[model samples]
Target: MDDIHAPTVASGLSSGIAPRDVSKVSMPDLMQEKERIEAELSALSSVLNSHGVNMNSSLTTFDGFPRDDIDIAQVRTTRVRIIHLRNDHKAVMTHLEKGLHDHFARLQNAPGATSANGTTVPSSAPTSVTDNSIADTGTLGTPFARVNSVEPGSPAHQAGLKMGDSIRGFGSVHWLNHERLSKVAEAVQQNEGRPLTVKVTRKNESGSGTTELDLQLTPRRNWGGRGLLGCHIVPL
Candidate 1:
């Protein structure tokens, strides 16, 4: 494992797990923490939106006095927290990137290692890096959505899809052009019964970390389940 040290954010807001702590943790733990921070940031953003303000919105009137329209103190606090979390998010991502490199390096260095005789050697079951998608662990890109549910014995299950997997790419759909997941629907509809390369970042089980995957999902209907994919997804 790599000893990655994340930068600290200076703010009144809690800085989340310390850099030293992260250095000792695995990639999956870091990923979960990243998701937690993102969720909090989303909630705080909603608060600002509810108050009819944004990060760039001025909280002062032309007279330069604090505006009475919104709760200035709460808004300021939320803004600070958001900023701090963003910085923390960046740091965690950096650590994750380094961890990913180290993980691959280990795999490449001794994939199916054998003795000098070169006879067939028995080894431990390949560490289940997370579901059947483990073999498809190279397309780690920016996630646009997250799997919320997956029906058993369904097409999604057959394709190795699992709940909580963050979707990076789905056929022609990606983070920048997902368009509120409308593109996802379009891709699915257009590629029904055909294999679509679905990329995702999945958190490993137990004390392990996270891994990226590229599943070949062939969407169809009436496979002992409702809908084509039999899964629910929500935008991240």
Candidate 2:
């Protein structure tokens, strides 16, 4: 004969009996215990979420990195630093662009600056000596030979040739193309004292491509590179 009463978990727990010995605890007591455990779990979940963990991952092992301590001030500092770097970069770029533009403008203006003499400084740009009819005339577009600078005593200078004049026409070639003009200039450059007849034209008016000065002269080893006259000719 055996005592048929089932043991209770609370009595066993209080008595230091293993939970496995629990067989019959009142329904209400079990329900209360379950509710208390659920409440504790809910509180723990809330704490984890505040610390940066996503609450949805609490029940799943696959839930990614658990939330840890969050520092709002650190995040703000990082953002500000990024913005500051971007602004500084923009400012530096703007300054460099302006400087580059100013440098080029100075280069262009240098050609027209005045010299120490009372007379307005002659332009530094190169000149050409030729007639209007390129080829057997004056040719333009020939970089092969350009007027360097007119010498103080030169035939082209007497002919009023200036610096930066381009040969536009040559014997028998009017409106000479670049190729033909280059060929003529090449010949003139080879023979410095050959007394090669040349022509130079200058822009008569600003921005007026059609209007230009027509001067007929000869090639001379002037001040600059192989050009049409004796003075000086520099690249434009």
Candidate 3:
């Protein structure tokens, strides 16, 4: 009886970064595969957070909900949930496709992605959720890392490093890669440990144009993590 209740699945396949389909499997297989997928996704929750879907868009906020679609007086929570997931499934598939493509593409680009040594290519490791201002985040015209959100007391935060500022030159190099900040810090002591200079650019609100600015910052002391600028930096 329990086996009869499993969702039917189709054959596993790929399409434009499509999520795996398991429709051909039996009830037990479906349950096992679903569990497997869920387990595989657990390590990347930060990158995989599925906020409630906004049917109105990936580019716009969902201005309204169809709450009134059902007669509230008779609708049950189970019914509401089922309906919501049904509506959200399409959107979920779209996002999944996009994510899978990105993930695989990155793997392909990684060193040794094609050969055993390919994946082992010598590369600057990525920065943690910490300081990344070491690299040249300065740019001649555009801002550096997409300023998703800036902290309240960090140097940039206090100096008016508002959200959306693209840091271009750190001390004198591009921080676009985002790992330079950490690399620069490791080399700072060798370079005299002076206060670092940064160049930042951001869009003009009026769309008139972009503007450039300069900032000076010293590394925070006793930082808990490598390359952390002692600021709360979140991805945009």
The candidate that wins on lDDT is 1
lDDT head-to-head 2 vs 3, winner: 3
Ranking by lDDT: 1, 3, 2
Each prediction's number of clashing residue pairs: 2, 52, 32
User: 1-236 in candidate 2: lDDT tens per residue?
Assistant: 22112112232223253432112434334333333433443454455455454322232134443223453333333333333334433443344334334443465477556555755554343222232322341113333335666666676776676666664443323231223244455755665665544445555557566434546555665445434555544322
Q: What TM-score quantifies how close candidate 3 is to the native fold?
A: 0.32
Across 48-145, the per-residue lDDT of candidate 1 in tens digits comes to 99899988888778766667888877787777778877777777766765676566556555767665598544543343222224324443456879
Worst 10 residues of 1 by lDDT: 1-10
Reference-based TM-score of each model: 0.51, 0.26, 0.32
- Residue ranges of candidate 1 with Cα displaced over 4 Å: 1-20, 111-232
For each of the candidates, the C-alpha root-mean-square deviation to the true structure, in angstroms, is 11.5, 37.2, 16.2
Q: Which candidate, 1 or 3, has the higher TM-score?
A: 1
Tell me the TM-score of model 1: 0.51
| Top-TM-score structure, candidate number | 1
